[model samples]
Target chain A: QKEVEQDPGPLSVPEGAIVSLNCTYSNSAFQYFMWYRQYSRKGPELLMYTYSSGNKEDGRFTAQVDKSSKYISLFIRDSQPSDSATYLCAMKFNYGQNFVFGPGTRLSVLP
Target chain B: DAGVTQSPTHLIKTRGQQVTLRCSPKSGHDTVSWYQQALGQGPQFIFQYYEEEERQRGNFPDRFSGHQFPNYSSELNVNALLLGDSALYLCASSEYGIHTDTQYFGPGTRLTVL
Candidate 1:
């Protein structure tokens, strides 16, 4: 099994809606969790970052991690058309250097 | 400030041919990491370079190699490339020794192996 799993969602929602994207990992040792946004033909941009299990908020984006369940999520409030992109979850062990990224979920917020 | 920059924005090569891609890190950043992103997938870590040496590597094969120059610029070389090697190659830079460092990525080089 792949260490990390995420729904390859082409999820579409209207503007002003709330969006939730999630990922699950098999490794219990992962301590650093991150969410990245990637537009078509562009590199992944770091959106939210969290250490261990907790929630971190930046603007309209909120990242939540549940270490016990090995599940993580990113919530986008008042989603906009500009928010349409692929969201990726990445994690790493505390002592490890490499970050493993999940197969991203594609989102499209329409007007 | 200019962000990370990669050369040869797009490339096409035949299977078994070699390819070299280049990257210059962001200003004040000393560490560089390379990633491969295939179609419909997220980027996968290839390796990282710091202090002119490879600091970490992922599960890539020996055919993939890299170099870091004194200026902190880096090169990724793939020898005897296979069709599977075709993917978007990204270069990310971050400061070493900074706790919980965030990587800044460049517009990746799109590599296509025929």
Candidate 2:
């Protein structure tokens, strides 16, 4: 099984809708979790990162991690058209040199 | 402050050719990491460089290698390139070492191997 797994979604939602993207990992060693947004043909842009099983909130994005279940989520409130992009979940062990990333989910907030 | 910067922005190469992509880490950053992103997939870690030394590597083959300079810049070199090598090569930089959660990325180098 892959260490990190995420649904490859082409999820479409209307503008202003709340969107939730999730990822699950099998490794319990992961202590740092991150969410990134990628535009078409662009590089991954760091959205937010959390240290462990907790929640971190930004302006419009919220990242939640549940270490017990190895599940993490990114929720977007009042999504906008410009918010359309691919969301990737990444994690790594404490002091681990390399980060493992999920397959990513494509999101389109239509007007 | 300028974020991580990579070049050439785009490249096209034939199979069996070799290519070198460059990256300038974010100002005041000391670590650089490279990743490969293929169509419909997330970025996969290639390797990381710190203090002009190869710090860590991913599952990629030896054909994928890198170097770090004293200035905290980096390069990703692919030898005996295959069509499968066609993808976006990304460079990320961070002030701290591997444990830094604030790693930042460049725009990326898009490579097309024919």
Candidate 3:
């Protein structure tokens, strides 16, 4: 089994809607979880990160992690057309380890 | 305070060729990490360098290697490149263990192998 799993989605939603993207991992050692946004032909940008099992909110994005189940999520509120991009979930152990990324989910917020 | 910057924004090469991509980390950063992203996949960690040494590496083969200079800049070199090696190479930088949660990435170097 892959260490991380995420649905490859081209999820389409209308503007102003709420969207939720999730990923699950098999490793319990992963302590730091992160979400990244990438546009077409562009590099991935750090969206947000969380070390705890709860939620971390930044502007319109919220990242949630559940270490017990090894599940993580990124929720977007009032999604906009500019929010359309690929969302990647990545995680790592503590320091001194390279991060493992999940297959990203593509999102399109139609205006 | 520029973000991470990579050289030769795009490159095209043939099988059996060798290529080297460079990256300059963000100002004040000291650690550098490399990742590879295929056409439709998420970025995969290649390796990471700290203190001019490789601190960690991923599952990539020996054909892929890297170097980090004293300035915290890095280079990703591929030898005997294969078509499967075509991908976008990304460089990320952070302040060694202090601000790892905020590792920043460059625009990435798009490598094409024919």
TM-score of 3: 0.97
What is the alpha-carbon RMSD of candidate 2 to the true structure?
1.2
- Expressed between 0 and 1, the share of native interface contacts present in candidate 1 is 0.63
Worst 10 residues of 1 chain A by lDDT: A91-100
**Candidate ordering by DockQ (highest first):** 3, 1, 2
* Candidate 1: pairs in clash: none
Isolated chain B TM-score per model: 0.98, 0.95, 0.96
Q: What does candidate 2's lDDT look like per residue over B10-90, in tens digits?
A: 999999999999999989888899999999988899998888988899989999999998899999999999999999999
Residue range A4-68, candidate 1, lDDT tens digits: 99999899999999999999999899989999999998888889878989999999999999999
TM-score of each: 0.97, 0.97, 0.97
What 10-residue stretch in candidate 3 chain A is worst by lDDT?
A: A90-99
TM-score of chain A of each: 0.97, 0.97, 0.97
lDDT tens digits by residue: candidate 3, B1-114 = 688999999999999999999999999988899999998988999999999999889889999999999888999999999999999999998887763546788999999999
- Over 4 Å off in model 1, which ranges? none
Ranking by lDDT: 1, 3, 2
> What do the candidate models score in CA lDDT, each in turn?
0.93, 0.91, 0.91
lDDT of 3 at A26: 99
Q: How would the docking of model 1 be graded? A: medium
Question: What are the per-residue Cα lDDT tens digits for candidate 2 across A4-29?
Answer: 99989899999999999999999898
User: Model 3 in CAPRI terms: which quality?
Assistant: medium
Off by over 4 Å in 2: none
